[model samples]
Target chain A: MLAKSFNIHIDNQDLLDEAFTQASYVNEHKGQNLKFYERLEFLGDAVLQLIVSSYIFQRYPKMPQGRLTRLRAAMVNEKSFSTFARECTFDKYIRLGRGEEKAGARNRDSLLCDIFESFVGAVYLDQGQATVEKFVQQVIFPKLDEGMFAEFFDHKTELQELAQADGPVDIDYELIDEFGPDNDRSFKVNVSIGDKLFGVGIGHSKKAAEQRAAQQALTHFDTEGDNLV
Target chain B: MLAKSFNIHIDNQDLLDEAFTQASYVNEHKGQNLKFYERLEFLGDAVLQLIVSSYIFQRYPKMPQGRLTRLRAAMVNEKSFSTFARECTFDKYIRLGRGEEKAGARNRDSLLCDIFESFVGAVYLDQGQATVEKFVQQVIFPKLDEGMFAEFFDHKTELQELAQADGPVDIDYELIDEFGPDNDRSFKVNVSIGDKLFGVGIGHSKKAAEQRAAQQALTHFDTEGDNLV
Candidate 1:
């Protein structure tokens, strides 16, 4: 089934199985001392980074490092990887614990992302870089050519650039409030441009909150006027 | 000269020169708009990640993903890369502006690290993966085999593990104080185990301060005996 899906020969069934296995599944079968996809996932994450970075580096030679970094960041993230995984129907094959399956973790973005990376790692181990590269090329390059990841620009950076485009202006992210238990805390951030409050956002972390705030600020600038000028 | 040092034939001297050219140097010669190494560094960093991760993944199959992650983080950061850069005499070849040259930026860890990665990127562009892999294998594998990066375990994680080795215990890092200008500030952190203060550390950033605090905490535990039990 895996061989047919990727259109590549995977000789090692054990590696493939390991790639699909999650920690929860392994924990459920602890006596067997089974391995999971995590190690492979780590390897595959690096593999993906190289493949993606190399592709963007070569494809966009004139693109600045900052932009390349942003592009790569946009591409090789949980959201994008999971989306790719779903496209290849990886969720259908993911081996989850009974509890996880009941909780619908098979379709979870984080899990799908891990499964995709682990699968890539498995392919690299089984077939080698040439085959894996070719596979990634086929899977990822088309979406990239269509400018799928262009939307994932860093909001904070975009805001900063916009603020500085006319002239330097003070932009600040202020943590206005935090709530919830210590373990499940959330942060509320208010982003201000000079004297005016442009946007406010809430997230699980300050960075996330700030990003959301910046995103809102960008949206504000999109519809509203640029008050900085 | 670079070809001689790496013992690989690099046909494109322009790419090689671009790898060594710093932005400062390019800025000094405005009309030329000569490309610098940042873009290549970005690409080379990814290349190095794949190469190093692949090597370590294959080498220690039983090593957990967490350990692999830590090890890779240790190996790929400024200290290790800068050391490797010096080994290749990269500092001698790095082109710098007069101001940077006088400021001794050529010998700086961050610059050296950037140059090394850019050099790898240049080689990847000129010679491709196999050649770059061979070069990195020669330069990096021996150091890795010697466990050069083993010392760089995340201090906070170490402290937490040590604190919990016998049973669950509270480990907390408190920001005791912060000082200096807004743009250039320092953080002071105190690490506490249970109710007792174990370490105090200072750094340019909160994370760094926390790491230092943890490092000191680990040292205290190592010398004064773990008080958790």
Candidate 2:
């Protein structure tokens, strides 16, 4: 099944099984003596980092360290890994405990991210660095090339750069509203350029909301008026 | 110099030179068209992570993900990397700007750490993964085997386990003082077990200070009394 999905021959089936198995499942079924994916995740995390870092390092030779770091962070962060997991159909293969399965653990971003790393780890151990690097290049590099990273767009920085063109206009993101429970709270933010409220956005985090608001503001500037001049 | 120090035959001396060259040096000597080590540092950081993660994963099969993560962080953190750099005498080989050299940039932990990562990156690029892994195994695994990682020892966890053995006891770390500039601040912390002050420690950050205090407390417990019972 793993070979069919990933298009790589599995030399060791147990490593693949361990990659799919969650700690929750291992704890519940103590007699089975199954190893979880945590160790694999640790190993995979490093593999992913190296592959992504090398790709970016080669692709963008003139880019500064700070920018390279930011880009790499965006590519390998939890959200990005979760996206990769979904693309690879990891949710279908993931082994969760009865309670976790009932609670929709398969859809959880963190769990999905961990599973993706574990899969990489399994690949590294079973096949070796060359195979893992090829796999990551095929899987991840396209996403990076397509500008899936938030840092690639960087709406806030764009807005700031635009504002600076018009002699330092004061731009601010105000949290206009916040609601929902602690675990899943949403924030509504308004991006104001000087006195004008240009755009509003909603997100789970204040930073996300602010970025969205800034993006919206930039769009408004693009479509409606030459606000910067 | 690197070949003599690391005892590895250098296939590309230029790559080794690039690893030691600081950005400040590049800026100072504009016509030389020399590249800095930042890109290599970025690559090396990932390589280091993979190597360390593999080592720990194989060494400790039963350790939990959280503990493993903590242990990896301790081993690969700025302080640890800086220590490695010092051990390798990277300070003597590092290329700095005249101004930075005058300012003693060679002794800077951040610079040392960056240089160390760059060196690893250089090795990876020059000789490939097998050679780099052998180099890292020779240099780094010995430190891990010696329990150089504080998270491996885990003073806080040890203290908690010890306290549990003697019935329920409240352990707390209080920040007694914070001084110096924001960039180079020192934090003084006191660790108390029950109502008695067990140890006091000072460090650059609160967490470091707390860890030191806990370590000191554990040392006192080891020498003074059978605190476990």
Candidate 3:
């Protein structure tokens, strides 16, 4: 299915087989000399990162490093990879132990992500990087053109840009409170423009809280009759 | 200097200049129409990751994904990159603001690391990935051959392997205490084999503390003549 979908060939059946083999299956079928996908996934992740980075680097020559980092992060995470895996219908092909299958590990996001990466790895191993690059271009670049991943840029950056679009404006994120135990700490933050408090948010990390606060501030700008961009 | 040292020619002098231009330099040299290296560094980082990952993946086919990750982490970080930057004498060529140069940003590790990445970016832009691969092979692979990065692997893996070399001893890391505020918390942990406590460690994070504990345990085995590998 992947071969037909991507229009790529894999001469090494072993690599393809290893790409879909889960550790559970190997654990259950010990002494059978079966390999798992983790090693391939490891290699594939770097391959995917390089291909995606190259694509965006060429596509958005003027984009800053920070936004590029954020955009790439948006595309390459477990959620996006798992979605791609499902599109390839890899869940049907993964070899899992009976226990893991019963536990629904076949459709699990991390498992799907690993499968997608391993598939890429297998393709790269069989046909090298150029083939893999074409594969990624076919599978991922269209979605990029559609702006499918643009929403993943955090609200903090959006708010900062919106606040400064008209002119120079002072935006501040202040940590208001921190609480909870060391292992499970929480932070509260408030976003302000000049002297007016715009939004308050609470989260597990300071960055998260600040982002949430920024999101609320953006919401305020969108809903209110403010002239802010 | 870079082209002569790497034996490669860059047709585009602007890209080469941009590779060495610091943000501070650009800030100070406003209206001169200058560019900085951050964007290129972003792309170069991904390129370097893929090349290094491919090299290590092929070099250590039997290595588990976890060990491969650790090994890659050992190589592709600020410390190692800065060391490589020094080997190339990047300090002699980096363009910095007057204040930054006076503050010794030329020799700083973070700056050096950025310079190294940007240099890779410049080479990739000029000569392409094959040239960059050869450049990295020339610059970084010899260090790998010399096991220059071997020491950077976390002690936890070493302790685990040494503990299990003789038998299937149950090794464990237990967090004893966590203290300090949310932003600056510290953890204390101890590693034990079976029922015997091997060592204790303290660090900013649990993983760090566990690694330190493992380091102490390795030292114990080394100094106490424990007949462990």
Candidate 4:
């Protein structure tokens, strides 16, 4: 499928299969000598980071480190990767266990994101870094150039601007709750604008939760008849 | 310096200077057309991640994603990168403002780490990814192979083992205090072994503080007459 679409010929079909395989599938079929996508996801993540970083580095020679970091994060994050996977029709190619398939894992954002990374990893192994970079430039950079990723980087600032335009409104993001183990904690946050709760959000980290809250607030303003600016 | 050490010819010397120049130096010499290391650091960070990730991926084919992530973090972290910079004698090459130089910024871990990333970025631009990977393998992978980074990854686990060796003593890492602004907060942690405070540590994050506390506790055991096991 990748070859047909992207013209990236995989030298080893086994690597491609490994990239598509989910852990659940491997775990369920215990006797099968199947490799899952986790390892590939790990490598692909680094490959993606390097490609995006290089692209932006050369594209915007004067852009500062902090902004570049934020931009790279915006491009490579779960939401963006999942979107890319969907655009590539990865849902059609992903292999899942019966249980996972029943649970709609094929359409899951996290799973899709993982698959994208794993695919990149497979490509890296099969064709090398140049091929991987070319694939990224051809497939991903177009979306980036179209400003599809700008919202991911600017949600908080945009929310702030929208709030302040109404004249000195107190916008506060309060962490209402946190749960799970220390290594993997989810935080719930509420965004309040001038004593009124505008929106609520939940995320893996505090900053993520705050950003989501701001995004929610912006969405709330958009849904209403209120002009954002 | 890098060219002489690595035997790779640099196409642009100005880029090398830019990679060494701190933002403070650029700001101080406002009239001069100077570039800081931050941009290069951004690109180099990704380059470093890719190289390290690829190295470990090939070296430990069967390692799990969680462990791989932890190992990569240990290798690419500020402490590790700063150590690499020191090993390469980057302190002598880095350019800092007079005020920053007076404040001993040359030896600062954060600055050193940033400079190393910037250096890698410059090398990538000057020579390319293959050369950058070769440089990393030559300079950094030897230390990784020697298990110099084992302490960074295994501090908590080592501390746990040490504590549990003497009939399952309760080990607690308590967050005593957190301060500074939301973006850059510092956490102070105390590691208590069986109701006695063994060590105290401070870091930019809670997890880092806890790790440092464990490291300190381990060091205390090592230095004192008390046997860790």
The numbered model that scores best in lDDT is 3
Residue B70 lDDT in candidate 4:
75
Ranking by DockQ: 4, 1, 3, 2
Model 1 residue runs over 4 Å out of place are: A152-229, B150-229
lDDT of 4 at B167: 82
Task: Please provide, for model 4 over B110-171, each residue's C-alpha lDDT reduced to its tens digit, 9 standing for 90 to 100.
Answer: 99999999999999998898999889888889986587876634678867865776688889
lDDT of each: 0.85, 0.82, 0.86, 0.84
Model 4: lDDT of residue B202 = 94
List DockQ, one per candidate, in order.
Answer: 0.63, 0.59, 0.60, 0.65
Q: Name the runs in model 3 displaced over 4 angstroms.
A: A152-157, A161-229, B152-157, B161-229
lDDT by residue (A1-229, candidate 2, tens digit) is 5577667877888889999999789879888878889878988998888888888777776656766787788788899899989988889998989999999999999999999999999988889888888788777888755767645657788688667666988898999999999999999999999899988989999999998888788776432222221
Q: What is the TM-score of chain B alone in each candidate?
A: 0.68, 0.68, 0.70, 0.67
User: Once model 3 is optimally superposed onto the true structure by TM-score, how far is the C-alpha of residue B213 displaced, in angstroms?
Assistant: 20
- Please name the candidate that would achieve the greatest TM-score relative to the true structure: 3
Give the C-alpha interface root-mean-square deviation per candidate: 0.5, 1.1, 0.4, 0.6
What tens-digit string does per-residue lDDT give for candidate 2 at B6-29? 677778888888999998898898
Local accuracy of candidate 4 as per-residue lDDT tens digits, A1-229: 7778888999899999999999888878887888899989999999999999888777766555655677788888899899999999988988899999999999999999999999999999989988998889878999865878756346687677668866888889899999999999999999999899988989998889997888788876532212211
Residue B178, model 3: Cα distance from true site in angstroms: 43
* The TM-score obtained by chain A of candidate 4 when compared with the true chain A: 0.67
lDDT of 1 by residue, B1-229 (tens): 6567678898898998899999889989988858888989998999999999998787776667766787788888899999999998889999999999999999999999999999999899989989999999889988855767545455787788768879999998999999999999999999999999999999999999998898788876532222221
Residue pairs that clash (backbone atoms under 3 angstroms), model 2: none
Better of 1 and 4 by TM-score: 1
**Which regions in candidate 4 have their CA more than 4 angstroms from the true location?**
A152-229, B152-229
Candidate that beats the other on DockQ, 2 or 4, i.e. the better one: 4
